[model samples]
Target: MSFFTSNRFQDRQAAAAEARKAMAEKFLSRPKYDPNDPAVKEREAKRRAVLEARAAREVERERRRAEAAAAEAARLAAEEAARIEAVRQEALARDAAENARRAEEERLEYERKLDRDARYAARKERKKKAKSPFERYR
Candidate 1:
């Protein structure tokens, strides 16, 4: 003998169908109806509204964060440009200083050469004017 005709199974199945129909009708209604003095349900609705608003606020916060990141990136780029310019200026100054040092060294070398040439010329003239030893003795 099967338990298919049990009274308990029939009652449970009927109750389940009724519950399903009620749920379906509630979902299909356009303007939802809340019974008068619906404090508990009102609180639940308010809670859901607050949760949705919080989600919107989070989206706005993310947008602002992205904008701030972009601004920061721009500022960093400008700073890097300034840093590169400063380095270029420093390199130019170093090159100028090196050139000046080289010029000064060349000037000093030329002056030393001129002094040596003058001394050599004066010694040659003295040798040419001096009398011979034999002439002096005679």
Candidate 2:
């Protein structure tokens, strides 16, 4: 038989026997991993660190964006409130000025009526006096 054929038969039979023995073993054993392999544990650690840094940076960026949005909303609310307050104050001032003007006009009309009534009463009394004394003498 050729060397390769002889080796393949032997390897297969041995592999079968080993698999059966492993199944019958009381406790299973884990395969040995190389601790000192150049691209093994170091590469995994670097990849994990990169993922963690990216996660932290994303969280920080989201927090800043949220803060900026909140500040902008607050500023807009304050501006709207100030504008409403200014409008209210202007309306109140206008109402007060109109009330004062109306009151002054009513006072002037009352004074004119009182003066006209007094003049009319005095003229009637003078006419009565002149007629009474002169007609009796004649």
Candidate 3:
């Protein structure tokens, strides 16, 4: 037969109940005011000291980490600023070059127009000086 349905199961239950009762009685018999004992006090003080030391170490570690992160951030920011300034300078130089090229082209066109006007005026003057035969008789 399965142990769960056997007579031995009753004996096991009884033994388990007795064990639980014994454990409860032992727990109740422990001294309640042991905190003032020398050994307990020394152990508590040592634990607190260890906890304080760990806290101090953690704080120092965090401070160093924060400083390192800030330094890295500042370095990155400086690099970005330098890159932006370089790009701005390049754009300014390009714009100045474009303006200079446009000014040169305008100057060349003006010079050509002046030469054409002078040629046209000379041609008109020559035609006016040469008159027809009827005009000479009059």
Candidate 4:
């Protein structure tokens, strides 16, 4: 005894073929798409608008980033210039102090030399006057 009345191999093959044809007919019965449909045009327009908005936003973001980078570079350059100026001023001040010290030393040395020469001249004049009045007649 079997569950099906006609459990023959030919009967099973015929039933399977009918089922496949029915499935293919069902798949082919749906309406085809039309490119000229208003709904499709509206969807495409919406997608284009979204893409444009996204591109505008990206351009604005890039502009802001470039401005920020330029500002940072300017700030760093200003800081470096200030630092260099400070170093230059300090060096000039140190050189001025050294020159002043040198000038003072040279002035003191000149005065000492002058004083020694004057003392030697006065002693020679005194020795010459002590013997000159009598030695001239001889």
Candidate 5:
């Protein structure tokens, strides 16, 4: 088993060395370019222009997205403010109605008390009149 394992490791190392050699040869065989060549310069300029255009488009898109977000936020804030104002108005109206009801109840109670006092006074006056002259002398 040990011998087989050592043999497998050596085989893997040999294969890796062969792969590196092949990669190096392939890289060297690729076409070389001259920096001063007009074709090379043109290709570089085209690539740079494309990259700049893409960046500009991205910036514009981001600006529009930010504007949209701000508009949405403002709209939501306005809606919330309107809702709050409506609630406040409703509360005020409720309070006014409650006050009116209380006032009406107090007025009714006062009127009933006045009626009872008048009836009591009339009864007392009748009793005094019913007493005769003899009762008054006693």
Candidate 6:
């Protein structure tokens, strides 16, 4: 290493070769994987167990989600049914109110008709009494 290098390309190529050799030596010094090793077999078993546990947890989570969805759907259905029932009840109440109002109007109209007829009959009776006895015979 120097503060500066006269040949930059040579310095770069040497550094690259040294790095490659170091990497190769590091890989070669490490213990190689042997399928028959007890430690390797134990690690594989542990990894398989962990993978199985993760799969079971995922399945459980999915099942819970489905149950929650079903519950939510039932709640929404109940709310909708209640809303429809309320609307039906309100409509029935409105119909009943309308019927009562119509009946009241009819009753008032009949009363007015009766009053008019009574007034006309009284005026006819007075006129008949005012007439002479001979006029009544004629």
RMSD of 6: 3.5
Ranking the candidates on TM-score from highest down gives 6, 5, 3, 1, 4, 2
TM-score winner: 6
Q: Give the TM-score of candidate 6.
A: 0.79
lDDT of 5: 0.95
TM-score of each: 0.60, 0.55, 0.68, 0.56, 0.72, 0.79
Give me the displacement of residue 93 in model 1, in angstroms.
0.3
Residue pair clashes in candidate 2: none
Question: What are the clashing pairs of model 4?
Answer: none
Error of 5 at 88 (Å): 1.0
The TM-score between candidate 1 and the true structure equals 0.60
Name the regions of candidate 2 deviating beyond 4 angstroms.
Answer: 1-41, 126-138
Residues 1-138, model 4: lDDT tens digits: 688587899999999999999999999996577778898889899999999999999999999999999999999999999999999999999999999999999999999999999999999988877767678789
lDDT of each: 0.92, 0.87, 0.95, 0.93, 0.95, 0.96
Model 6 Cα lDDT, one tens digit per residue, 116-138: 99999999999878979888799
Residues 6-109, candidate 2: write the lDDT tens digits: 56778999999998998867345743567687667898889999999999999999999999999999999999999999999999999999999999989988
Q: How large is the C-alpha RMSD of every model relative to the true structure?
A: 7.2, 11.3, 3.8, 9.3, 4.3, 3.5
Decreasing lDDT order of the candidates: 6, 5, 3, 4, 1, 2
Highest-lDDT candidate: 6
Better of 3 and 4 by TM-score: 3
* CA shift of 138, model 4, Å: 22
lDDT, model 4, position 120: 96
10-123 per-residue lDDT for model 3 (tens digits): 889998999999999999998776888998899899999999999999999999999999999999999999999999999999999999999999999999999999999999
